[model samples]
Target: MSKKITLFAKIFSISFLFMGCGMAVFAQNKTEDENVIRCGVGLLSQSPTIFTKKTVSNVSVTASCSDTTVYQIPVVFHIIHNGEAVGIGTNIPDSRLTSQIRILNEDYRRKEGTNGYNTDSRGADARIQFVLASKDPQGKATSGIVRANGGQSEWQLSEQAALKDKSNWPKDKYLNVWVCNLKNGAENLLGFSSFPVNSDLDGLPTGADSTTDGVMVCYKYVGNSPLSTRYNLGRTLTHEIGHFLGLIHIWGDGFDCTSTDYCNDTPAASQANYNCNTTYDSCPDAQGSDMTANYLDYTYDACMNIFTQDQVARMRTVLCGSIRRKTLWSEYVPQEEPKSVSMSLYPNPVTNSNVIVAAVTDNADVTVFNAIGQKILQKTFTPTADKITINLPEYQLAEGCYFLKVVQPSQTKTFKVIVQY
Candidate 1:
């Protein structure tokens, strides 16, 4: 089993400069636990309030997954432990993990019959897939999972400690997630994503993408298990993966009531709520209760079974860009082993300035995309010790989401950026 990391006090110098500006756009909160859920949304919105409506129905929520191209995602599981086998309750069964992956495909692509969330079950089946890597950072094939014994794992702002040997996986090839026994007050915290395109691991050289840390329950309650249905539902991974792909909670942070979860389509709830029998209306001024059914909310697994079209669009944007896009359906087939190039995007979610691109080896042309899958920017970078910058000022992009791609000689890197108005 992996060692758990604490989170009640993990601090990173993130900007709160615009936190107060968008409080009025959300619905009124019903309580505190709900507020914690809502605070998760607080991180998603840029507006003061989010509007809603009863019009959003099952059809609106259903996503299309007609495209069945398998997306091959190189996965690296970091098993942090104090003194236990890497494969513990925390380590989900491979069969269960595979089921969860299938769920992601079904949900994201809206596969029929398996649309557990009751939303429209149609779209390019994200044709994407994940595999446990057989190689380590040293160029050895791995089981896509890593295990380390003993380490101080805490999410405290300043004490964001790293394990003893945290540098064995290669970020450019694998989607790294550290799984462990979450320290006190960290369970339900599940996982959090490190903004992609940034390789600086604040404390260690763990250039992985997101951190999936939590308590591992037994088979009766863990992955794909109905016993622990609510929390253990595949939804936890789906939710965290959503964050990995750049989706915020349905409600913005808890600073105020109006902030959105960053998605223009998702309603802004004053605060996020937990299981509720009564249908509470949030932001009555605008529309429906904050999308409690959204995976980003604090609802138990069974309660969350859908992702809206807008949410789908946001995720597709990541898969379509240079970051995770190429490995997505139609881009990369399972027939051939993928060849990746090293690249980076700077000033993600750029406003007036252009995003800088850096190629690790040889310089290559790059492409940029908007929310609806339209190419907005394109350029080529020459091999240079310094990065090359591409101006997207002409796109005149409004406040929304976007993706950037940079192709290099080895592995390709894609990044999802949010444009703030």
Candidate 2:
């Protein structure tokens, strides 16, 4: 319950895999006689198609380029609600909102967090970074989350019924997400998203129709509860953000699942579902699951929680290419602590299976990459007791120099790992 829900967030969910049956398709059920998206349960039952259907652009390169700079993004949460707003007035509590933002940054940057039921074994923290937006597009100071009272409406759509006008917000400087009680048809709408309908008018993709654009959550489901409210997971915002960045659902709309959401690498599925059955191979002939772990899938919040490497590539392209998302990185100034800045690998002139990681925080996540940056060894904690031993006996990492990175929330440390195997 942070701030306003944009039309983009509301409608965008319609395009996700699980519920290809979205607002636009289900809008017929609303009293307003507006467009509504249909809601279908299982997406895995679909067929398969060629992987590379749509390209990001002619310059949309996949592998890491010569440019080593990382992209940082700023985010502003607009929490719209009808109840006595929580999170101490800034909409949802700052702690929860910050937690959500941190989760976004982590997911975008490929960090890890508490696992969900459907999370993939592969831990992919998106390489980008995110922070609360301190400045709006118009250059105004902001709390990052806004609050508006929509009266007794439970669904975000009901609140939208109160204020249907688009002038209520500043669309460009801020990505608006309205949270309210929304009922589309058979199942209550979780959230929705869309790009700018009039990109030329504002030069920013605007999301309106909060009833259909932003997230719709029941009041009881809005907090940081473990899993009580499966639909309110912040990952919903993650999925919508995927759409905002131009990635599409793995499954295509209609009965045809192979249509392609335009992103290469995501396998085609005939339909999307909320069930978190890893064995539920919808498109068995395809290379992988429709990426049900992807934040964009329709599985329950606890069931759906992972972004694939290919998905990360697509998101990175969006950040670097179209959204000017690099601007968001303008704020995060990493601390100057050298230990926080880089990690150290001991026994440089060595000849053994065990290597020591010195002077690092306890329980730090570590990754060892080859000269080309391919990760070979990844572990959660580099034990704290004595000299932390890393057994590199398997990689047959040649007698050469490699990179070792130690990471944790808010910081990353890297150093050289000279091997003699």
Per lDDT, the best of the predicted structures is 2
TM-score of each: 0.53, 0.55
Q: Per-residue CA lDDT of candidate 1, range 222-313, in tens?
A: 24764353465666666766655545566544423445554546665644556633264556675656566677776666666667656665
Q: Which TM-score value belongs to model 1?
A: 0.53
Question: How does residue 162 of candidate 2 score in lDDT?
Answer: 54
In candidate 2 the C-alpha lDDT for residue 274 amounts to 48
Alpha-carbon error at 247 in model 2, in Å?
A: 1.6
Error of 2 at 300 (Å): 2.2
